[model samples]
Target: MTSLLRILRFAPQLNPLYLGIAVSSVLAALLSLATPFLIGAATDRIVDAVAGRTGVAEAVTAVTWLAVAFLAVEVAATAVVSVGGYWGDVMAARMRTVLSTRYFEHLLHLPQRYFDTALTGRITNRLNRSITELTQFLQFFANNAFTMLITTAAVLVITGFYWWPLAVLLAVVFPVYMWLTAKTSTKWQVWEGEKNTEVDVASGRFAEVVSQMAVVRAYNRQEHELAGFRERFTKTVGLTRTQSRFWHGMDAWRRLAMNVVFGLMYLIVFVRTAQGLFSVGDMVILLQLMNMARQPIFSMSYLVDSAQRAVAGSKDYFAVLEEERERAGGRALEAGEVRAVPNGPAEARADVVEGETVPLPADVPAVRFTDVTFAYDDDAARPVLDRVTFEAGVGEKIAFVGESGGGKSTITNLLMGLYPVGDGRIEVFGNDVAGLDLAAVRGSIATVFQEPFLFSGTVRENIAYADPDATDERVRAAAKAAYADSFVEGFDHGYEQIIGERGLRLSGGQKQRIAVARAVLKDAPILVLDEATSALDTRSERLVQAALEELMVGRTSLIVAHRLSTIASVDRIVTLRAGRVEEIGTPAELSRSGGIYAQLLQLQQAGTKEAKRMLKEYGIHG
Candidate 1:
């Protein structure tokens, strides 16, 4: 119920439409009440003619006009109802769009930990089901509730003509119906919430299996997966059945109670007529009024059911909407002129390379972290990164190497402002990252992850993703620099060849090259390579690495390397252990110091030797 109220607060623009619908509903109810009176009048005329108090021909003519007027009222009422329905649909669509858009924007601003703790399917279910339920609640349930109110009032007015007994009977019966409906609706809502949870779990499981189909097939876990899905499905079906049966039983009881009351009302009217308390036409009008009252009572019960469902669905939706977005408060990164550095072969002198470095303005460090700390949850069982303080000078190439959980990715996320700092601060280019515009912060850096992500598009489009407005010459130049042009040109479609989902149509090397091309096209001052060449073969790695060296010439580069050989030539390495920086020095200094870096180097050499030995054992070597 609280959730439903929150969602309804999004539509201040729909108030006028709701007002119009309400007015139409009241008018329709008045027309419905008049219908029985018209019928009663026609009946009274017949009774008069039988008594010889009036002529039959005049009554017949009056009946024809009354019939036409009734038909017109019915048609007009339906038109009003139709207009109300159409307006409701439009309002629902706009509200759904507003809520959905807010949800997406909020998600974009959420911290990395939020995503780690939340499932994609659960979020998707809440967004979809909430909007759908909210729309129906406004369109049908809300309108019905209002219509029922007006109809009840109209019925009371008409009942006054017959006798006060019928009105008293309705007064007693309506409360009982409402009480039963409320009780049944409460149980139904709980069951519906449970059913939605089961649905989310089942959907998440299906998504997981489909995403990892290769692994599932490899382990022959098809039957196991099927059994898991069936268990969730059975639970959902069972709950749905239980809820349906209870509501159906409640509906049957309500109908029985209503029929009993209706029968009693007719008996009273008939007895009164026999006793000369009322004429036949009056009894007829009493019966008609009783039937009219039943319409709202029956409809109200269904409205209660719909309202409960909407409340349950809105609870899930608002839960997501109410979640806090990533904090933003700091200074914006000042964009400076990018001086083009001279590109040359790998053998260029160190002094020349140092001279080519682009100078950052005095206000900005290439990167800065002050007393930073981060935890996935507030409980603080373990911190992902703790008191991590570091600063990188402009145009410096810094590499981070450590075990898998050493917080390398977490650091990158913080730098990109994807997560808020738990303690202290993070600044990029002199501006506190938290205070800067997220899109602007992200736009200032170009990243190439270990596994490149490519949407379904032509090679040219994929490369141009970094800068959508990049010219053809710029795209070709970046591709050529990344060594992607040679192979791309060989394809019949050349740059226009469409890649399949996630670039599955391309080999690992080809995809990496294209990703590299994209980053190069962006030409941001900061470049982050997270195991960028980890997926490529040695030959491809050599070619891509050469291209990367050119790209990294004067830019500030942060490299996360798995292979020791990849960062051997880098200026400095920061070794992390258990979410803390353990070592920071030149590659040679760390290699000779016999620390984690030395151990990694030894492992890499041993692995290389083992690979060679395996080739020799197979009698297939260069």
Candidate 2:
């Protein structure tokens, strides 16, 4: 009930519409009171006429009129109820849109850790359930609950008009009934909360298994997974059974209370009639009104249940919204800087400034890291990157060579502002990346990773991900440059081929090429190749390397070096050892220096020549 009241606190914004709903509800309630009076009067006349106390013709006439009046009252009540429902729906829809959209928008901006750590099914289940209950609870409160209150009050007042004692007796009993219900219902509220959490857990497990069915089958763990699911399912069933039995017990007591109240009201009516103070028709009306009170009386308890469900659902929904949003305190991206230009591509809008758009100067490095230090977690003893400083000026291709934990990829993550820096600065075009919109900072750089992830869409759509509005000519050109055009054209649908989820339908080499095409299509000033061509056959590597060379011609590129031979043509190579700069020089200079770079190069060229020999037999080069 507290949650119910708290949610209704949002009703002030819908005052005018809510006020209309209120008026309509009252009208319906007042009209409902007409039923008992009209029927009671008609019943009296029909009885008298049948007994010859009144002429048959006159009684028939009177009864016909009463029936007509009753019909009219019902019609009017129905019309008023319809109008109330309309306004209730409008308010409900508005609230749903505001709350869910805001919730989803919060999800969109939440820090990366939320997505990485949260369960997909749990998030979705909470989102969906919360929305459903919130809408139901709110809509019922706005119209149905209001109407019930009015009907209850109108019945009491009409009873008082005929007999004040009856109304007073009700006023006292109603509060006690409500109070008892609240106390008992408090316990069931915990049941609803427990059920919701268990559902989330079950949903999460089911979702994970469904998404990873292949792994489950390969590992032959179906029985193991089923045992876990059965455990959760049994717990849910036990909780549900206990909650239902308790409610059923409470229901028996509720019926006893209702019967007692009905009998008391009947006894008082009979006493008044015996005292010659009330007519039989008056007694009939009191009985009719008492019967009408049943729905609203039970409804009060039901609504309390609904309110509890709403409260529980709201907790889950707000938990998601309460997560920290990404820090976006930076200048907005300039028009034509990252996203596609409004009218056309960048080539078409070379000097066309549509509005107050700022362009980066031509001479500044595409990106620069100055004494940057970072850790994924703040309390960690060792940082991923410590005082890592480097610069990639315009069109200068630089590569970072390191062991697995040497923080090569972390540099790119820092530059992209995916994580907050523990200390120091990263700049894009001389402006602190922190002081520029993170989206814009990311937009200015096109990245291709080792494991390219392509969504389940057509080849054209995947390639045009960087610029959804790209023309067919642009898509084909980018694909051709990345050597993806040959295979794509071979497909039955050509550019429209439906690649399966994560591009699983395509070979690894094919997926990487499409990724390269996507980056090429963006034509951003900065390019990031994070082991982009690693794990490919020599034949595929050569093709991808050629495409990489084409894409790097004008943009400043940062290459996370995976192999020694590939990066020999780069402007400079920075060797990182255990998260610190160990050496920095040209490939030729490093090879001649007899240091870490020289040792790494010698070690790589020493791999048993058999694998390389077989690869060379198939016209492959590495």
Candidate 3:
């Protein structure tokens, strides 16, 4: 119930039109109340005419007038209903648009970990179902539920006028029904929660399998994936059956209770008619009123159940909405200048590389991590980065080199402020990153990942993503700088060629170069290449590495490099081992020290040779 109220706070309002809808609803309901009386009177008049107690002409006239009046009222009620329904739909559409957009904006602010760990289908299911269910509930409450209440209230009023005792009986019967319903609805809520969870699991499993179609085929696990999906499907079917049966069981019990009361009311009215205390017309009204009341009573379980489901769905939606967003900070960023806090002087550092340690010049480094430590999970035994510290002076190029799981990539994630850091401060321009406005901090840097992702758009559109309002000439210049202009111009449509999803239509070299072009266009003070050329072939890697060099020239650059060419000219190489920094020095300096950095470099050289030998055997290399 609380969740339902919370969801309704987003409900669209018709403002002054609500009064019109209400007036129309009340007028329609009142017109309906006239039915029982007019019907009863017409029946009595025919009886009176047949017995010669009333004149034939007068009886016909009275009956004709009554019919005309009923017709007019019915026509008026229908018109009122049409207007009311139109506003109801308007409100429903507005609510759906507002709620869904709010959910989207909330997701934009969510931390990266949410996307990392949360199931795609579960989040989508919750988002989709909440909006759908809430919309239905709102429409039902505004129209059908409102109509049912007015009809019930009108019946109660007429029933009391016909006979006080029947009204009193109704008052007693429905209160008991409501009390039982309240208890049953509590149990239904529990079941409904479980049912929704099962649905999300089934939805997520289907999505996961479909999205990983290549992996399933490559691994020959089609049958295994099918079995997994079937298991979830079977569980959801069972839950659906249970939900259906529970609702019907409760509905049947309530119907029986309502019918029993109705039967008793019939007997009471029959006795009164026999005693000559009431006319046949009065008995007609009594039965008509009870029938009207019966309809709402029959629909009670459905309305109550919908309310419960809406409440549960709203809670699911809010669960995501209520999560904490990236914390905001006080620092402002300028377009050309980047703020990077340098680590304390490398004095007393165990991981110091053997060479004269150069303190990053104090012009406020473009990027800095000082004793920064963090673990992806609190229960993780060892943090991913332990007391890791580094700094890049303005326009200085630094590279992180290590084997996988040694935390080379974690540095980029931290610098981008994608995750929260707890142990130490990361400074951008001397301001603690934790205290700097994240939007401004992120806006100050550009990143190109090993897997270059492209949206489904034209070649020109992809480049312009860095600055949507960039001029055509500006975009072309950026592309040329990354060495992508030649390949792009070769396309049949030139820059207008539509790239397939994630640039699947482009070669590895082409995609990486376009990604670099985007970074070039962004022209931020800082650039990060996280294994950006590692996945390419020799030719592609050479092209992409060359493109990266042009992009990094005037920016503070951080590279998590896998190739010797990428590290050869870096100002400093920071070596990581088991989540701690092993050394920081020039690539030449580290190679001479014969430490962890030198050993990893040697292994990579061997792998490169083996790869070349394999390529030569395949006639692709000399």
Candidate whose TM-score is highest: 3
Please, what are the lDDT tens digits per residue for candidate 3 over residues 315-424?
A: 89888878876555533232222333224344533322212112333579878899989899999999999999888888899988765677778889988889888699
Q: Poorest 10 consecutive residues of model 3 by lDDT?
A: 349-358
Query: Candidate 2 has which clashing residue pairs, if any?
Result: none
lDDT of 3: 0.79
Q: lDDT tens digits, residues 109-130, model 1? A: 5666678878776777777887
Model 2 Cα displacement at 271 (Å)?
3.7
TM-score on alpha carbons, each prediction? 0.87, 0.87, 0.89
In model 1, which regions exceed 4 Å deviation?
A: 330-360, 377-382, 457-462, 471-473, 486-498, 603-622
Question: Scored by Cα lDDT, where does model 1 land?
Answer: 0.78
Itemize residue pairs with steric clashes in candidate 1: 329-434, 329-435, 330-435
How much lDDT does each candidate structure score? Answer: 0.78, 0.80, 0.79
